[model samples]
Target: MAALGSAGPVLLLLAALSVLSVAVFVARLIALRGASAGAAARADWLDAVEGGAMPGAPVGGGAPADRLLARAAALLPRRPAPEALTAELEAMGATEVAALGRGVRTLEIIGLIAPLLGLLGTVLGMIQSFRALELAEGAANASILAGGIWQALLTTAAGLIVTIPALVGAAILQSRIDRATDEMERVIGRAALAAALPRS
Candidate 1:
């Protein structure tokens, strides 16, 4: 922390961003975990729908696929138009996908800006070092220039340290959300198909 303080505000801000990035990733990870049922359960739900019955989800209704299926089942008996059912399920799926994607953009922005912040810190450090050298006049030594250069370089390294994990976390979380979205579409589309409620 003291070292971070010495590096200056940009580095300190980068550290705070790193902490925030990890927190967002962890929170999203926990929220996305088990957010979809296993494939077999999904298959069973589709089968039940096709079999002309409204079936309860194998587990909780919190999963995206489960919610979408519930919506379709609720509308099945009404015998709504094929286009209407498709539209409704698609709308619900969009909402679910958007909810899953929350916080992912923050991770991406942090990953992108961290390196730039590091470069800014490096530039600031270099300016201070040059100013010190100018003040020393003929008394300036190699150590003075070298020490400043290395200290200035520290921000660059710190920026990369923050960037890699944030980007990787964003990628992983985004992939999970995408898979859930696909699942929601598949389950709901099949349910709509089985009930003869959609054009496919």
Candidate 2:
């Protein structure tokens, strides 16, 4: 496009960085959504299994939590020791929770690095503007200088746009994970206690 062609090299580089930032943001959003949804489903499944209800036909074939719940229900009745049963269930929950928490590290890294990238872009743009001014034989062109400064500002805005939401999303997902973990601990405790009781 004519407009894009008019953009200086520094602006083009900033645009590329912005695009990359947006892509990372989108990926993180998808990961967080999946983690929250999966955790919710796992909690529901655990609750139903603990209440002695069987899960319905597998949705989209089957989920890992569903397989785990089924396995626990079958083995737990035959397993004599409550500690062993609890240990197995805890292990299963740990793995599922770990999967849910994946991509959190990437989000954190992006949040911390995006601002720095923006700063780098800003510095590069300013350096270019200064070089132009140094080479100018006569008065510096205000329009050219303004354009470079605007590009730097735009890059900073782009970085914040990517980072602020990612940081907040990571926090929200983390809280969801914590709540799910608490629910798991309670459910596992109840199951262990019930198993420890003597048969009538």
Which candidate's TM-score is highest?
1
Estimate the TM-score for candidate 1.
0.90
Query: Tens digit of lDDT per residue, candidate 1, span 15-84?
Result: 8999999999999999999776576677886787676666654564568888877777677767777678
The regions of model 2 sitting more than 4 angstroms off are 1-69
Model 1 worst lDDT run, 10 consecutive residues: 191-200
Q: lDDT tens digits, residues 48-77, model 2?
A: 645665465323213444445455556655
TM-score of 2: 0.68
* Lowest lDDT block of 10, candidate 2: 1-10
Residue pairs in steric clash, candidate 2? none
Estimate the TM-score of every prediction. Answer: 0.90, 0.68
